[model samples]
Target: MFLTPAERIADYQARGWWEEIGVDALLRQAVAERGATLALVDPLNRKTLDGCAPERLSWNELDARVDAMAAALIALGLERDDVICAQLPNTVDAVILFLAVARLGLIISPIVMQYREHELGHILSLTDARAFVTVPTFHGHDYAAMAAALIAERPGMMLLTMGAAPHGADLRALAASADPASVAPWCAAHPVAGGEVLTICWTSGTEARPKGVPRDHNHWVLNAKVIVWGTGMQPGDVLLNPFPLVNIASIGGLMLPWLEVRGTMVLHHPFDLSVFLKQIEAEHVTYTIAPPAVLTALLKQPQIAASVDLSSLRAIGSGSAPLTPWLIEGWAETHGIEICNIFGSNEGMALMSSPIDVPDRTERAHYFPRFGAEGVDWDSPVSAVMRTRLVDPETGAIITEPGRPGEMHISGGTVISGYWRSPELNGASFDGEWFRTGDLFEIAGDGALSRFYRFVGRSKEIIVRGGVNISPAEIDELLVSLPGVREAASVGIPDSDLGERIAVAVVVDDGITPPDVAAVGAHLAAAGVAVFKRPERLVVLSALPRNAMNKVVRADLRAAVLAALES
Candidate 1:
C-alpha cells in the first residue's frame, strides 16, 4: 500500500532521513523505556462528547489496549492493508484505534466528526474502506447512525462505534472482551514497514470537493521532526492537543512528536475554554497548538487569561490564519510563552517559525525560516534535507526576487508524492517530484533574515481590484489587529467598474461598542494600506460563514456581502 517508489524509499533511507521502521516500532520503544509514564489522557468532557466516561492510559496500558483493539479488528475480518475509516472525537479510543490499525499494517482514513453523509459517502466510495469507526452521538449529532447509513451504501463495510450502538459492533466492548495480548503473534508475523501508507487525510475543501492526501509512515515521522526541533520538545514533556487528529496539524505536530519524545499527550475537545485551562493547569502541559481565534480572545480579555497559571507552557503553535503581531508579542511579554507560527498543508508542506529560528515576536508572527531553498539557509536541520522554490504561477518560471509573490513548490522526505487516486490533481499539483502548494508567499527578509518566507494569501483567494492585485489575507490581518475587530474575513465582490472590490465582514467583541464603519476606514488609512486594497464595502455581522473545518468560506461570504449591498 506504499505509494512511494522503491528508489525514493531507498534514497531517503540511505540519506538517513527515513527509516525502515513503522509507527508500531516507535510505540514499542516508548513502551519498553517508559512503560510507567503517562502516555495518553482523554478529553476532560469526554462523557459530554460521547456517552461514556473518560479514560487515561500509561504507555504499558496503551500498548496492551492497542493489541486488544487490533485483535478485535482482526476478528471482524479486517486484514493487513485494509482501509479503516474513522470519524471519532478527540478521545483516548481514537488514538488507540489508530495505533492498533497501524500495528497491523492497515491504512486509516480519519475524517472530522463534523462531516456528515455527503463527505462520508464520497470517502467511502473512493477508499473502499473495510471498517468504519465512530461514536453513536456527539454534540447532539448521531454520527454512528450516519456511519451506519453510509456503510449500508457500501456492502461488506463493517461499522465499529466507540459507544453503545444499535447500528454496528461496539468497538469498546469488543476490545474489552478480547485478550490484551491476542494480536501479538499476528503483528510479529506480519511485520510492518515505515514506507507503507498509514493514513489518507482529506483536504478542507472550502471551495470544492475534498481531495485525499496519502503519506507513508516515514514521511509523517520526518514531518514530525519540524515540530520536535522547533518547539524543543524533550522526553516526558506534556503536550495538550486540541487540533483534530484527522489531519496533519495533530498527526505530525502533536501525535508523532509526542511519540518521538516519549511524552504525555493530553487531548482536548476543540475550543473548550474551561476544559483547556483546567487541563493546562492540572496536567502541567508544556506545549500545545491553539486556534487563531482563541488566541486572539485571550489577548483581548486579560482577566480570563490571568486567571490561569500559564508558566508551564514553553511554546504554542498556531496556524490556519494569520496572527496579529500583537498576539505573538502579547503571549511572549505577558506569559513568557513563545508562540510558534506553523505553516503546513495536508499535502506535505512543512514550514515552522520558532523562537530558535525566528526569535523576534513580530518576525515570528509573519516570517517562516525558508527551509529547503537555495542561497537561503536556516539553523534547523530540515533545511539541509528539503528543497523549496517559488515560481510565478503564470510564467512557470522560478521566482528569486524578494517581495514578488509566487506559488511555493517543495520536494523532500516530508512531501507526499501525489494525492490518493486523483490523476487530475496529481497532474496539476506535481512538477516531477515537487508538490505545488497553491499558497502564495514572497521572500521577506534582509541580511541573515533574508532567508524567510512571508505568506501573502492563497492564490485562489487573491482579490484583483481594477488592475492591482490585492491579498485579502493581508487586509484581514490588518483589520484584525485594530481594536474592536474580533473575527474578520475579506472577500472579493464583483463590481461593474472594477473586476472585483474588497469587502470585509467583521464580528466585534462582546459587550464592546462596535467600531463605526468610518473608524474602520480611518484605521486602514493610518496603516498605509493602498486605496485599491482598502475595503470598498464593510458589514458588521454577528458571525462569519465558516466551513466544517472552521475555515471562512469566502464564496459564501462574497454572496452574503453582495446580497446585503443589493438590498
Candidate 2:
C-alpha cells in the first residue's frame, strides 16, 4: 500500500533522514531493553469512550497483549494489507490495537470518536474496511446501533466492539482467548516491511469530504525523530498525552517518540483541566502538548493554576491557532516553563520553535526558523531533512522578500506521498516535488543565518471585506491580548452592499462585560490596524465552537451570525 516515489525514498535514505527500521522493530527493542518498566497509564477508566476500567501496562505486558490480539485478528480472517477501521479514544486498548495491527502487517485506519454515521459511512465505503472496531456506547451515542446499520448494508464487513458487543464480535474475549503459543508463530510468519502503509488518518473535511492520508512505517518513524529533535526528549522522561491517537500529534508526536525513548506515557481522554493538572503532578510529567487557547485559559484561572504542582513540566507544545506573545512569555516568566510553538499537519509538514532554537518567548510565539534555510543550520536533526519554500499564490513565483505573503510548499521524508485513493486531490495538492500546504506565511529576519518564517493566515481563511483582504489571525491575535478576552475568532458575514463584512466572535471571562464593536474597533486602531481591517460587528459567546482538534470552525461561526441577522 506504500505510494512514496522510489527516487524520494533513495534521496531520504542517502540523507540519513529515514532508515529501513519500522515501528514494530522499535517496540520490540523497547520491550527488550525496558520490559518491566511502565509503558502506559490510562486514567480515564474508559468512561468517556466505554464503561471499561482504568488500565496500566508495562513494556512486556503491552507486547504480550498486542501479540495476543494480533493472533486473534489473524484467526478472524484479517490478513496483511487488510484495513481495520477503529474509532476509539486515547485508551490502553487503542494503543494496543495500533501495535497489534503493525505487528500483523495489517493497515489500520483510525477514525476520531466524534465521527457519526455520515462520516463513518464514507470512510468505511472508501477504504473497504474488513473489520470495524468501536465501543458500544460513547458519550451517550449508541455506536453499536450505528455499526449494526452499516454492517447490515455491507454484509462482508465484520464488527468488533470493545466494552459491549451486542451486534458483533467481542474484542476483549477474542484477546483473552487467544493462545500465546499459537499467536507468536503466526505473527512471525507474516513479516512486515518498513515501507508498507501502517495507517490511514482522515482529514478535518472542512470544505468537502474528508481525504484519507496514508502513512507508512518510515513516515511515522521519521516524524517521531523530528519531534524528538525539536523537544530534546530524553530517555525515561514521563510524557502526558491528551491528543487523540488518530492524528499526527499523538501517533507521531507522542506514541512513536515514547517507543523511541522507552518512556512512560500517561493517556488522557476528554480533556479536563483538573485531570490534566493531576496527571502532570502524579506522573511527574516532563512534557505535554496543548492548544494555545487551553494554555491561556489555564493561566486565566488562578485557582486551577494554584491547585496543581506544574514544576515537573519542562516544556509545553502548542499550535492550531495563532499564539499570543503574552501567553508564551507569562508561562516562562512566572512558571519557568517553556512553550514550544509547533506547526504540523497530517500531510507530514512539521515546523517547530524550541527553547534552544528560539530562547526568547515572544519570538517563539510568532516565528519558526526556516529549517533548511541557507546558513541557518542548527543542531536539530529535522533541519537536515526538511525543505521549505514560499511562492506567490497568484503569480506562482517563489517569494524571497520579507513580509510578502506566500503560500507555503514543503518536501521532506515525513510528508505523505498523496491522499489515499483520491487522484484528483493528489493532483491538486502537489506541485512537482512539493506539497502545497495552503498556509500563508512571510519570511522574516535579515541575516542569512537568522532567517525565520512567520505564519500569516490560511489562504482560504482570509476575510474579504469590500474587496480588501483581511487576515482573521491578525485580528484574533490583537483581540486575545485584551484583558477580558478569553478567546476570539474573526469571520466574514454576508452584507447587502459588500459581498462580505468583517465580524468578530469573542469569548470573554466570566462576569466580564463583552466588548462591543466600537470598543473593539478602538482597540484595533490603537494597535495600528488599518481602517479596512477593523471588525464591523462583534458577538459574544460563552465559548467559540471548535472541532475535535481544537481549531476554531469559522464556517460555523459565520453561519451562526448569518442566521441571527436573517431572523
Candidate 3:
C-alpha cells in the first residue's frame, strides 16, 4: 500500500519537500532542456558483461528507450498498478525497465542480484507479480532455468528474459517490436500520480526475512533532495556509481541526483577498484559513493593512489560502518577529496556529515548534526523537512544529555509509513509517526541548539561482559586505527565465567603480520580504551564478509569466530 496519507501529502507539497511533478515529468524536463547530453554511461557492459562496446545514452536516446519499453509493457496487457519483478544487474536494460514501469503506472519491484531460489520465491509469491524480468544467465547462474522452474509453480506469471527467451518472452524483442509513436499516447492515457507506489524494494534481511518497502514518487523525490542538499551536489556533475540499483543508495544517492542535476552517470556493476578508479580518471567523475572499508583499502595502496588521476573528484560519500578518522582525513589531505560520512537505511532514515557542514575531519567521522535541531538550522533543503530524536531504550525518555546512548527515531517526508503488506512488522517498526531506527546514538555537543548526535552501534549488537555493556563500535573504531589493520569488527563470544567475552575479527593488510590479542589490548590501552571494553579474543582473516551492499555482516563474523574457537 502507498504510505503517504492525503493530509501528509498536502503538507509536504506545501512545504516544498515534494513537488507536484512526478519522476517521469522530471526526466521529460531533462530531455526538453539537455536532450543531447550524456545521461548514462555503462562501461562494465563493454569490458565484462556483453563483450560489446561500452553503452552511452543521451537524454533523448534514453527517453526513446523508456517509451519503447513502456509501449511494449502496455501491449503485453500489463496495465496501471500491475506488478513487475525485475531481477537484473546494473545495466541499461534495468534503467529502461524502471522508467517504463513508472511511465506505465506499474509497480516495479527490483530484486538484488544475490537473491537465490528461496528469497526470490518468497518475493514472487508475496507480490504475485504479473511479469518477471531477468537475464538468461548472470555470474554463471542459469537464471533462465531458474525462471522456468519458478513459473512452473505459478503458471500465470509471465517471464521476460534479457539475453535469451529460453524460459519465456524475450524483452529485447518486445522492446524492438513496440511503435515509439504510440508510446506517448499510451503513457498519457495511463498517467501515474506522484503519490502512487512506484517501487517495492526488499530490505537486506540481516536479522529476519526481508520486508518489502513500498516507496512513492514523492518519497523518492524527497530522498533525492536530501542527498543532493546533504552532499552539496551541483548541476551537470559527473557521478561514478558502483552501488547496486535495488536500494535507496542508488535511487536517491545516484539516480535521483543525476535526474535532478541533469548530469552524467557512469555505472559500474560488481565493484572492481582498478576499474572504478579508471572510470573516475577517464570520465572526470565529480562525486561517487563508497563504503568506508573500500575507501580505507584504496587509501592504503600507494601504487593505486599514484596511478589514478583523481583530480576531478570533489567528494566521496561513505558509511554503513564506523568511519575511521584516519581514513577520512587521509583522503582529504592526500587526494584533495572530501569524504562525506553518510548514514542511511532502506527505511528512509538519513544522517550525513558533509565537508561543507562539518569541516573538522575528526568531527565528521563521529557526529551528524541532527537535522532540524531546535533553534539551529543549516542551509540544507532537508533541514526543515526531517526531524530526529534520541530516546532511552529502557525508560522511553527523550535523551537530551551527552554521552548517553539512545535509539534513534526519525520522521519526515522521506520516511515510509510502514513495511509493505506486513501488518506485524508495521506495528513494531513505528512509534506514532517516527520510525524506530534500531540504531543506537548518543547526543553530543552542548546547549539545546548546538547539540548533535553520534552513532553508537546497534542496540542488539552491544557486547555484555559479566554485567558491563560494551559497544563493539567503540572497540572497532579504536582497533581500526592500528598500523596494519585494514578492517575490524568486534563481537561477543560465549564465555562460561563472564557469560560472554569480547572478540574481534580483523582483515590485516597484505604483507603485514596481524597483531596478537595482547598487542591489540596494549594498543587499546594506549588509546585510553577501558580494559572491560577491550577485545579478549582475536581472529585474523584475509577479508571481512560483506553483503551485496558492501556492509560487513557481523552475524557472519560472529559465527566465523565461534567456529574458529570451537576448532
Candidate 4:
C-alpha cells in the first residue's frame, strides 16, 4: 500500500521503526509540518579556524530559498533530468543547491573541490553536465580561472559562481531575487516522482576511470529510512556531518536522515577537530558522522574535554574508513556517545551495524555482527534487502558455506545499476543481476557478519591515494618511457594528509643515481598522466620489491616505502 508521507512517518514512529520511510516524503513532510523550525545551520566563519559561528535557517526559510533557486535554475534552462555539477566546499550554498536541484527533479553531480582538471574532466564528460555551480576562490587558488579554462574547452556548459563572478558567468544572486511566490507555483507544477533520478555521484577509485552512479529519490529515501532507524535519530536532533558531502555516508547517512526526521543540521566547512567539538557544545549537536580519526583527535584535545559540553550528543555514525575497537570504546567511555561502525563503498552501503533496538554499550564484540563461513553465509536469503556472497578467488565460483573467506559480491536495490558509458565494465560488473563489490571478506558464526574482514587489497594494481584510484600499471608504463629510467614500480605509501601517496620505486640504469622530485614531475608531465595519479614522492631502490616468482609484491613495497618515509 502507498501510504501518504504523514501516514508513513506516523506508522513508523508507532511501530518504533522511525527509520523505514523515504527521505523525499520526509523532506516534503518537514516543509509541510515543521516549516517554522530551524532545520539547518550554516557556519558563517571565514574558511578558517577560530571564527566559526552558527547561522541558522528555519525550514520555511530553507524551503523558500530552495524553491527560488530551483525556479532561477529552471529559468536559466536547467531541465528535469539535466545534470548540474557542484564543486564547492561544505557551505550553505552546497546544501541549498542540492535541495533546489532535487526539488526540480534535476540530477545533481557533486564533486570535491580538491579534484583538479584530470578528475573534473572525466565527470564533466561522463555526466554531460549542462551547468556547473562553484566558488570563485577556495583555500587560495582562483577557481574562477579553472572554471573559465573548462568553459573554454566545453562551450556548451553554463556557469554559476557563488560570492564572486568571472566573465561570462551568471551570478548566484539571481537565486536570491527569484520570488518565492513565483517558484511555489513552479514547484507545484513540477512535483518530483519517487523513482525519478535525483543525483549522479561519480565513484572514487584509483584503478579504472570513475563511474557515474545514478541514484533516484526512492533509493536515497529508502536508504535514509534505514539509516534513521539504524542510528536512532530524533525529530529535534542536531546532526553534525563531518564527512565530505561527496561521499554517500554524508549524503545518505547524515543529510538525508536529518531531512527525513525534520531535525537540524549543523554544517562545518571542513573537518577541524577542536572546532567540531566546540560546535557540538555550541549548537547542542545530537548526532554526527565522523571517522575514527576525528574521534581520536577529539579525545586527545584537552580543551574539548574541559571547555565543551557534549551531553546532548546521542549518536556518532562513523564511516569513509573502518573504525578500530579502541576508538569506539574510548569515545563511549568518555563521551557516552554510541559508536556505530558502518561498512560502505562508493557502490552502496553494506552491513555490520549496531542494532537500534538495543542501548549503546561498549561490549566491543557486540558492536559489529560477525558473519562468515564458520557461522552463516552473508549472501543467504535472510539478508535479502542487501545480498552478499563469498566466491572463490581464482574460479569466481560461489562459496555456499560459512568457513571460507573469498571475494565478496553484492546485489540489491541500493547498488548502482551500472557504470556510466562503460559497456565493457558493465558487462563484467553485472552477472545478469548482481553488482560485484570487488572486496574480499569472511563470513562469521551466529549469522552476524564480521566487520573486521581483511582488505586483501584491490583486485587490480591501483594505488588508493586517499579514495582516488591511481592505476600503477598506467603510471609504470609512463615512467619507463622517460629518457633515463631502467624500470619503475608505482606503489602507494601512507601519508597523513592524502590517505596514500603514489611513490615510484625506480631501478636506475647502472650509472644513474635517484632523480629529484622535480625531474620525476617532468617525466610524468611528458607522459601525460593525470595530475593526481603522478607520483608525489619517489624512492630509488637497488631492486624492486618482489616475491619468489619475481612478481613485484606491491603491498610489501608500499609498507617498506612508507616506513622509510616515516623514519
lDDT of 3 by residue, 261-283 (tens): 88889988887888899999999
Per-residue lDDT of 240 in model 3: 88
> lDDT (CA) for every model shown?
0.82, 0.82, 0.80, 0.67
| TM-scores, one per candidate | 0.83, 0.82, 0.82, 0.83
Please give the lDDT score for candidate 3: 0.80
Cα lDDT tens digits for candidate 1, 95-193 = 999999889999999987756565577788889899899988887767788778778878899998886878898999999888756687888798888
Error of 2 at 313 (Å): 1.3
| lDDT, candidate 2, at 567 | 65
Q: In candidate 1, which residue ranges exceed 4 Å CA deviation?
A: 205-207, 461-567
Model 2, range 1-567, lDDT digits (tens) per residue? 667777777787888878966789889999999999999999654554576778889999999999888878977988779999999888898899999898878999998776666567889999999999988887777888888898789878999987656788888788888876666676668677667899999873223345799998989988878898888788987899997788787898899999888999999988787888999998999999887667887778767878889999988987766687899888988788989988888888899988888887778888998887555667777788888889899999988778899999998888888889998878888987789988899887567424689988666665644333456765677787776788888888765335468888888877899888898888876664556667888877777878999988887888776665566
**Residue 160 error for model 1, in Å?**
1.2
Which residue pairs clash within candidate 1?
Answer: 372-388
lDDT of 2 at 174: 89
Residue-level error in angstroms, candidate 4, position 429? 2.0
Question: Over the full model, what C-alpha lDDT does candidate 4 score relative to the true structure?
Answer: 0.67
